[model samples]
Target: MRVVLDAMGGDNAPQVPVRGAVQAAKELGVEVILTGKRELIEDELSKYSYSGNLIKVVDAPESISMDEQPSKALKKKNSSVHVGMSLIKNKEADAFVSAGNTGAVMAISVFSLGRLKGVERPAISTVLPNLKGHTFLLDVGANVDCKPHHLLQFAVMGEAYAKYVLGDENPRIGLLNIGEEETKGNELTKEAYKLLKKASEKGLNFVGNAEGRDIYSGDFDVIVCDGFVGNVALKLSESLAKILAKILKEEIENHFISRLGAITLKPAIKSFKKRIDYAEWGGAPLLGVKAPVIISHGSSNAKAIKNAIKVACQFAESNLNSYIEKNIEKYG
Candidate 1:
């Protein structure tokens, strides 16, 4: 399978993404096409010794900045993101991965790859690492203002993604709300709960309402919400993890005894970091699209990009779009 990488979009740009493409080409045994300025990409490739010959570069002169609006930026045909999406549209690549602006990625995917049959709107689904395992959350900053039906679609798409990616045959789903009671949320959540309840009767494992406090406890395998609330939850969790890590480091370095103990417990701390690290999870997939599109962190390193490539490969091989199309009637 051929996976396209946006080499000029993220913070580290050509260097980190190039290294990642090389690693993924060697380790995953898949072809990687890097899209960016040819000279910059070639220069970075020179820094690494790659065993496989599966890596290639596609030159893109223009690049969309993080601040540019998706609608306006898409008009630039020469942009790196545009070039990458064109490759998918032309069947030159199996999937497209970018660490660029999230809005642009969503907009470009919809415009170029188009939405799948029976899908009204495409939503972004992210994997949240928890104590028991990972909880899949959808509409995470994709559509801020969603109708009740949009949320129902999010649940349907999220369930399909969690089941296929997480290897769960019957993943339990929950609606994010203020309380566990059925009549506890705003109009949106209340209407969404009813739709999900009806969906449960038709084969989906709907576990009812899930509050914010229950998210990290693995109360459900998939949590469904509008983009507004989902974005808040995702950002808050990420920020809290970083703050907690910093505080722990400060405490460990405060005294000689504590420093010694920290050294002894370094391995345990590293393990803890890995568990909460967003990089370890790779990227978020844009579900309900005809083709695979992954949006990685803007500050992603080589390892994160490599993992994202692996994720794209898995999604392509799974034939998830066909599965979702076959099961869409059950969700409605």
Candidate 2:
């Protein structure tokens, strides 16, 4: 499979992304096209030894900064974000991967690749550690404001990802709300609840509302919410993980007995950390787009970038967009 990487997208830029491309080409056995300043890309690439054809570089003179406005950043046609996304639109690449500005990535993807047939808005689906392996959450930061039907669309797309990519034969879908009761939540959830119920008749494994505590409980395979709520939940979960780790470290160092105990439990601690690490999952997929588009964190390292490429390859191989289109038509 051919995957395009935005060489200048992350905080580490060409350095980290270039190293990642080389690793992916060598280890994953996939063709990687790196888009960015050709000179810098080659300079970093030269530091690594790999097969010539497996890794290629495309010159994209401009780059969108992490803080740049999405709409304004798109004007730079030569930017890495635009160039990488264009490669997908042109079918030169099977998927596009970027660690750049999230907004710019979403905007450029929609403008270049367009939406999948019957898709009203594209949602960002993030994979998080859950009790039963992992769960998918949608609209993580794509559309801050959404109507009732939009939530229904998110549920459909989320279900597609769970079934196709995650290999779930029947993924449980839940509306993220304050309570499990059907009567709970605002007008959006109330109305969305009815819509999801109707969709369940069409074969969706629609579960009732999922409360905040249910997120990591693994009771639901996929949770649907507006971008505003999803984003807040995502960030809060991240912060909670970090703070908990920090508190553990401080306590471990506070007493000699605790430090000794930590040493004995080192392996378990390491395993726990790996479960929460974002790099393990690589990145979030922007669902509802014409082709696979994986968006990684701006602070992604080489491992994260390489894994993101793997995810892009998986997405491309899954033919997920086609399934999403069919599901939308089936449930709409």
lDDT of 2 at 164: 80
Candidate number of the best lDDT:
2
TM-score of candidate 2 relative to the true fold: 0.98
Indicate the residue-level lDDT of 189 in model 2.
92
Q: Taking the tens digit of each residue's C-alpha lDDT, what string does model 2 give over 1-332?
A: 99999999989998999998998988899899999999999989888877568998989999789999998997999999888877877888999999989999999999999999999999998999986788899999999999999999999999888888877788999999999899999989999999999999988889899999988998999999999999999999999989998998998899899888887898998998888888998999999999889999999999999999998898899967888898899998
Backbone clash pairs for candidate 1 read: none
In terms of lDDT, the poorest run of 10 residues in model 1 is 323-332
lDDT of 1 by residue, 229-328 (tens): 8899999988988898899889878877988877778798789878877777789999988899999999998899999999898888887888888767
The per-model lDDT (C-alpha) reads 0.87, 0.91
Each prediction's TM-score versus the true structure? 0.97, 0.98
Error of 2 at 74 (Å): 1.1
